[model samples]
Target: MFDLICLGHAALDRVYSIAAFPPEPTKLRATQAMEVGGGMAATAAVAAARLGGRVAFWGRVGDDAAGAAVRDGLVAEGIDVRGLRTCQGAVTSTSAVIVDAAGERMIVTHLGEGLDDDPAGLPWPMLAQARAVLVDVRWPAGSLALLRAARAAGVPGVLDVEMMAGAALAELLDATDHAVFSRPGLAEFAPGLPEPDGLAKARAAGAAVPGVTQGEHGYLWLDPAGRARRQPAFAVRAVDTTGAGDAFHGAYALGVARGLEVADCARQGAGAAALKCTRPGTRAGLPDGAALSAFLAERAAAV
Candidate 1:
């Protein structure tokens, strides 16, 4: 049985490392560049697989060279891609990421028609074997469908609330057991609430639990009992922060599948993200089972 099933878009990411944001109308040479598989759900699947979870990914790609590259990357990471679909007239989703020396990034994405395809075509029986299902906002309709099915199957459903519109945001949260919001995304959902207060508001809106991830500042989570807690970010020199959040989600899902407490899950996620930032690229820097175990052990001793 799979520990987790991740459903959303899969993309080929072209990352450019620069010292700073380019001046308006001015061109700056990239200090470094790399291409790899990326997308909230896709990257999370790879992270889970790397951490020794039995994972599967359901997403849509195009019939193009980029699509092949993405599919190959996931398979190499040990993520089952039997459920991945290929779209006919569309190009695979793509992203151009610009990272500053400080490890901060600005990304421009083209989601393409990846979001329009139905995820119900996925192997339902196989998906049902998963302990939990994770989805991103990139594919609204498919993600909603998967969440409903997971709920009916009594499996946990997690929503990675990335960039989304208002109504879509509400609908996504309503279908999720846990809602983890990006900072800007949470502000747009609850304009007046302060950062910590926003987590409470999101939880009250229907999510069993709500959390906001503040990079480097740590994460603030409101548990199912209405108690809120903040976990400080682990100290590390971030070389590239591109996949940190994805690593967090994957490790958090692993914790959930293993029946770890919510607070413990958040801590594990934080630890994984911190380790991811110590290296370069998204998939390249992800920790394997042994590495994560050692890191977590050291973290426990430090605490």
Candidate 2:
């Protein structure tokens, strides 16, 4: 049985390191470059696997080299990829990520075309073996379908609210037990509202836990008791921040599977996110179980 199942987007990322984003649309020199697997749920699956959770990735990819890279990358990270479907003739999603000296990154993505969006053929029975399910906004149909099924199966569903239309957000929120929004996603959900107020809106819509990931600043959430809580980000010299949020969500889902309290789970997430920032690239920066444990232990000792 898998400890967590990640369902949604997956892609290959071509990353470049540069001193800064060019102010003008002009030629610039890259300090470094590499290719790696990315996408929200896909990276999260890698994070959970690195943290020693039995994780599985469920999503669709094209039958192409990019798709193969996505599959092989996850497999190398010890994630189960049996559910990663290959759609014939479709092009797998891909992204160009450029990271600057401060570790901030700008990404341009091509979602690709001719891909199947239907979740009907997905293995619904697998919910029985999963302790928790994580979904992203990239695939509304698949995310909603899996979220509903996970809810019915009594498996926790964590929504990576990266970005979505208002209607889709509302529908997914109702079925989501834990709705963790990206900074932009929270603003889109509750425009002009404060973080606490925005998350409150998510709570009103039936999400038991509504949170946002604040890079460097850390995580903020409304707990089950209606109390607003915070998990300050661990101090790290960031080399890249590309997949930090994904790492947080993955670790948080694993914590939920382990029956941790919401606050503790956020700490787990924060630790993972901090560690992820210490290196370049997406999956390359993820910390393993031992690393995460040691990081958390040191933090505890300092406290």
By TM-score, how accurate is candidate 1?
0.96
Per-residue lDDT for 240-281 in model 1, tens only?
Answer: 899899899888888788788888888888888999998878
Q: What are the root-mean-square deviations of the candidates from the true structure over C-alphas? A: 1.5, 1.0
- The most accurate candidate by lDDT is 2
Candidates' C-alpha lDDT: 0.85, 0.92
Question: In candidate 2, what are the lDDT values of residues 119-215, reduced to their tens digit?
Answer: 8888777789999999998888899999999988899999999865446888999999999999999998999999899999999998999999988
What is the lDDT for 154 in model 1? 92
Location of the lowest summed lDDT over 10 successive residues in candidate 2: 162-171
124, model 2: CA deviation in Å? 1.7
Cα miss at 73, model 2 (Å)? Answer: 0.8
Candidate 1 residue pairs in backbone clash? none
On a 0 to 100 scale, what is the lDDT of residue 234 in model 2?
93
